[model samples]
Target: MSKGERMKTTAREKIKQQQAAQRQREKRRRVVTYAAVGVVALAAIGGGWLYAASRSQSEEAAGGDQAPVTVQSDGSVVMARSGVEKPVLDVYEDFQCPACKQLETVSGQTFKNLAAEGKAKVVYHPISIFQREPTRGNSLRAGAAARCVADGRQWLAFHDILYKNQPSETVEGFKTNDLVTWGKEAGVTSPDFEQCVTSQKHAQAQLSYADKVIKEQKIEGTPTVKLNGVALEGNVAFTPQQLRDQVTKAAK
Candidate 1:
């Protein structure tokens, strides 16, 4: 219990206390570093999400006109996705598809008026499933012939008549020889028209297009349609009234 010994012991204790304090300060520094790292990570994730959303909007706005589909060789009878500002309908229909015929019959002038006024744009995707050879009402033959009429500036007329008299699965609506007669009804006069109908050159294009559409969009049935590329109920028929409602809702 000498005073010098007591002083030495106290000094050792003081050194131990100082080391413990330094350890605590290092621990605090580490805690602060981890907290700062977490905050930075959260901010980065938030920024990435915002950037992706903004880029999507920019791309949507920059969407260009659809490429002109070749219903005609002159590049005139062009069918495409209409880029008209509000309430554009992009419809996929087969010329021999009975459902499509029904829709056209129901929405005929109403649709025509909408197109004429530019309030709506109707993009008809003429698919050829129901028109094939022999039982040739709903297959490639109808589609190619439609292209023939469309090539000469009678697209609308051809569209209407073809739908109106859509031949049933058993009966080909208009005979091949009768195409010349039908062309006159659509205002296209060509001795060459019959030759084109018989030529079957347009079949190559139609088949290629149908294959492309099926692969890209995953469409399964006839009259598959989309409003702004959003697929809807395909098994049943939809009326014009329902279509109008969908257009309004989508625009909103």
Candidate 2:
């Protein structure tokens, strides 16, 4: 072939090669775009599925039949009672408060024993004192959920479970679903308990009760103990033995 013809042929080949390369690039771009869209779609679907499952569980819990709650005159959840003549042992606590948790850990069983033996009646007033960010919302929700548990006559067990599974103070940890899970762990398997917890059914009532007790009783903080309407000396006013002794003295 002549040199000019050869050059023209080479130029045509280069153009063809360029077109092929462009096509390849476009194809790869399309693949990447499609893959990205698929990822987003899958994520959305997964998120929706999770949300639906959570809602279904909550609904099943709420719609399930359960017994009614028994409210005390002082707006406390009666955890245990031996008899009408038993001295009243009122306990004001916040679920999210570490101090309250500590008090429960230390004195819970003692109080339960006292109630069982007709020495005292233990009344739990779950209040919200940690009304700051990250803890307040969950605290109130858990408190309301406790009321639900009380309806089922499992308030003390569920209360102990909550303290046992207490999360850090920095994060809002008691998600409604989590509360239901813990309630189940605490032997609250009924649908009514789950529904009440998930819906936070007694949230407003709990808040009002807390406020009323706080105002009326002049409560300054949580884990406040009262023996027959008089506040205890301090948080550690009673060891197990000391509590028993005091109850014995009060009974006589």
Candidate 3:
């Protein structure tokens, strides 16, 4: 090759290298700028961030105060103070649903607090809304296990444990052994409770009841919170303080 051509090739390679270096510099600058903006935004919303964190923590701290929980014949769990039932809060939820988990995290304690205070009757309808495998099975098993102990003293504790241990939708979870173990942790010492969970004794019943309620109530999704038989708006249903306010208004 000629020296002139060689020199030209060398110059082009140098230019390409310089251009690549410039691009890298620009990318680094953009990243730093974005990080700075993120810091400013976090600082601006610090209060909101703290509130969100506290709300999540509240779920971990719930279940201390609850009224007597009674399991109805149809597999629904009812929580209410004696003879204090002016307003009813029906919470329809699928154990395997992510949004249902979020709703529980936000307002589960509110349900207990309301019922304990004789403010409302909180009826928990654990249903299976998942159509696919793994999640459908998981929901059924979990719902059945919850029903197994619903009549006992540990129903509410087991209910919270199920939510805390909810698995992902794509994979199988809430295995029989885990259910039994969690039941024991929730104070279910009855041998029948373990057998009921292991054998999935209430599985078919739970499925049938879920289907019946879905059709009768025209429920389209999980985490359906109804106040006095009327569905609550998303904003009110998912917010704990808002739910309390709405229940107070209903009681009055």
Candidate 4:
């Protein structure tokens, strides 16, 4: 119970407190190390996923093997594998038609796939059914631009681009510059193509062909799909999976 005894007890208590603090610090360092490791593991997994997604996108952009596109004398485009011909699918579409764009959004790939597999001969008949002002012009110009590149080996790509970039019916769109730019984007660099798009060289011919088909086939709408000369119902025409099934059945 003297001064020396009291000093010794205080020093022992101080050492215990320091040891507790050191243990707390070690626990915190362990927690931080585990959290950092977890974060790195998650980041590595995310990076792998991102890389896979990027590669998939690149493959899609490359646009793997497609069927041959032949421009008939009548201005319609026929796509099919070599020497394979049956189950003709006639697609009548207007570039400015919203419903036609919707059809393209849903079943465009089905058409391409069918033709690529040599299961069907897909005929693209670009038409202008709009009688109104701006919409009519847009349809004509886009249809003519399509014809300009019908045999340019990029027609399918250009066709998709047009529908992807279709503007409102009230607006004046599909201008010559945009058409030419899209043609270039579709890999059409010929001076003849530029001139044809600029002049809308095939506009009258496209109109005539559309008129002929409309009268002969009794076509009433923009997205009129006929498989093997029989009109496809709306339910089967616009749905991608159903369209594919129908075509496959027809092929068999």
Candidate 4 wrong stretches, greater than 4 Å: 1-64, 150-152
Cα lDDT tens digits, model 4, 139-212, are 99999888887553688789999999999999999999999999998987667999999999999988898899
Q: Quick one: ranking by lDDT, best first?
A: 3, 4, 2, 1
Q: What is the lDDT of residue 210 in candidate 3?
A: 94
TM-score of 2: 0.67
* Candidate lDDT values, in order: 0.62, 0.74, 0.86, 0.85
Candidate 1 C-alpha lDDT tens digits along 1-252: 999999999999999999999999999999999999999999999998876444332111113433333353421233433565556565677777787776676554444544444445556667655434544444676677776764423666777777766676776555666655676788876557677777765777777777777777777776776766766564222554455556657667
Clashes of each: 4, 2, 0, 0
RMSD in angstroms, all models? Answer: 14.7, 18.7, 11.0, 9.4
Best by lDDT: 3
Candidate 1: C-alpha lDDT: 0.62
Q: Which residue pairs clash in candidate 1?
A: 130-138, 131-138, 131-139, 132-139
Candidate closer to the true structure by lDDT (higher is better), 1 or 3: 3
Worst 10 residues of 3 by lDDT: 55-64
Q: How displaced is residue 36 in candidate 4, in Å? A: 47
Q: Measured by TM-score, how close is model 1 to the native structure?
A: 0.60
Alpha carbon deviation, residue 44, candidate 4 (Å):
40
Better of 1 and 2 by TM-score: 2
Model 2: worst 10 consecutive residues (lDDT sum): 58-67
Residue 204, model 3: lDDT of 93
Clashing pairs in 2: 61-195, 62-195
> CA shift at 138, candidate 3, in angstroms?
0.6
